[model samples]
Target: MNQFIPCGLVPRLAVTVVLVLVAARCGGGGPTTPPPPIPTLTIACPTAEPVQSTDNNPRVVTFGTAVATGGVGPLTTTCSAASGAEFPVGTTTVTCTAVDARGVSALCTFPVVVRPPPRLTGTRFLAFGDSITWGVDSPPIPAAAPSFAYPEQLQQRLAARYRLQTPQVINVGEPGEQAQDGGIRRFRSVLLQHRPDIVILMEGTNDLLSLEVGIERGIEALRDMIREAKGQNVRVLLSTIIPQRMNGFRVPNRNPFAVLVPPFNDRVRALAASENVPLVDMFQVFAADMSLLGIDDVHPTVRGFQVMADTFFEAIRANFEQQVAAGVGGLP
Candidate 1:
């Protein structure tokens, strides 16, 4: 009673079904699609502190050695602070970032500390005087040299006492110069130029040599110099002249200049007192000891200079300590 089905039609139908399944699996009808990839990035921690110079002012810092890792291939690297460029003093943040072509990025940060220079690093002192102040008989030696003139020795001693910065003592001493030349022609300009914290005024020996010019001229010149220095707001430390001997021996009697020296020193004391300035009394210590004198009657030997340094150091210590205690001046 049932009708018979066609065998060829059944086979064609089976083949058509297989083709449809293959098309769907291959995406033959539309664009092909793939699974999305996960993005990745990483940054290494810096191992050391950034390097920089210690100076009074801000300076450049460098950090080209910082490392970064996996992002997309062929990564580009950059930093927030450029290498070898000026940076401010104190802690500066440095960030180094690496970016791949795909825009995936990684970053690392570290701190750089730029310490400011030591306080009061330049302690300026103008050693204003004649040949003696210039480190005469023996030329002035550097602060680090073995043998120092009084001024250089004074700087060393002061540094030791404070246990802090080394002072710069500029010797502007002219050999054979009287107070007239120093105070009138040289004092004001030097004071203005150097602008030192202290001026050690020691002159008058040459002026004493001239009986006609007299000691008064030297005294007056010193007074003028002191006034000029004070006008500039610079402190003055007045030093009395040291004893004189002839050729490493006592001078014969009738040394007219000897009489004048004591009086000249007396005048120096009177001037310092009148002006209310500090005094380094070299004369008091030297008056009894001819041994301190150099081959020349006027100049000091090495020992003499050391003695001078000792006297000056005492005055400097007192002044420096007083000022520091009162919160006036010392290490900034």
Candidate 2:
């Protein structure tokens, strides 16, 4: 058979066979490379320093200060004490964690001990405000029946949640009394007299309604209140006014006055921020369900007052807990 074929044809045929075999082999792709493994993270707290306290309690020990891991990226840290571990009377433990950008995490614990809350024999809280602050539109209307205003509700919630002794809450809200009036004559005589641990200032509604005072004046009044309170070492919590959708407007003439609400709230928010005071945004809470207000649309109903009280309770509880943990001697 080879003798009959051309000499070039044999070599060509051999080359063709080799090319076919190569094509067949290349038809299926080669195996793929595997992905890299995810990095692991671990955390620990090392006992290093002991905190001292005047109270007769065990000193607290802190855990690891630095987090070490194999991976690299931005890391976030969080700390918490172990469960069921009683913070020794004089000391407490704090745990911290570091998390990398890849979601890897590491943890550490530290101990810090200090004097506990002073055996506060008693504590007083004062609330100052306008009509709403006085529970003007509260329900079960005998018009004369005592309305459990937000302040009273706040007291109850604090007692239940924090196990704090029932504090004497004095409500000094005078209906129709503008902040100007309060700043000039009322605040000192009534509020400063009690030596309150905390003071809640809810004024400015009357100021906005009566004098149409601008935001600057409101801020000044708030500053004055804060200055007075700080002089006595009393902590202050400022609250924004709830929005009013009154039927009659007072600005350009007696028409719908809803437009005024936003401007007033803006001023109050700015004042709160500049003063570095805790602000309870009551308008948003009440505005969540518009039906909570009374028929007149200015005052919140009983349910509305409950919601307001709850809001106040949340802010107050957080502040109190922090102050307690810090062993700071001042109103939270």
The number of the candidate with the highest lDDT is 1
After superposing candidate 1, which stretches have Cα over 4 Å from the reference? 1-122, 138-147, 246-254, 323-332
Residue pairs whose backbone atoms clash in candidate 1:
none
Write model 2 residue lDDT over 1-332, tens digit each, in one string: 22333323344556665545554455534667898765676655556443333344444444445565655566665566643344555444465777878887777655455544333323577888877777777334614214568778877766654343555667776776667666546676665577788888877666665444534566577778877787777878888777766552233442233555667777778877887877888878876777777666667778887887888877776554433444422111
RMSD per model, one decimal: 17.2, 12.6
Q: lDDT tens digits, residues 73-163, model 1?
A: 7877777777677765556667888888788888888766664433332367888777777776532422222346777787777665444
Total clashing residue pairs per candidate? 0, 19
* Alpha carbon deviation, residue 5, candidate 2 (Å): 63
lDDT of 1 at 178: 87
Relative to the unseen true structure, what is the C-alpha lDDT of residue 177 in candidate 1, on a scale of 0 to 100? 86
Which candidate wins on TM-score? 2
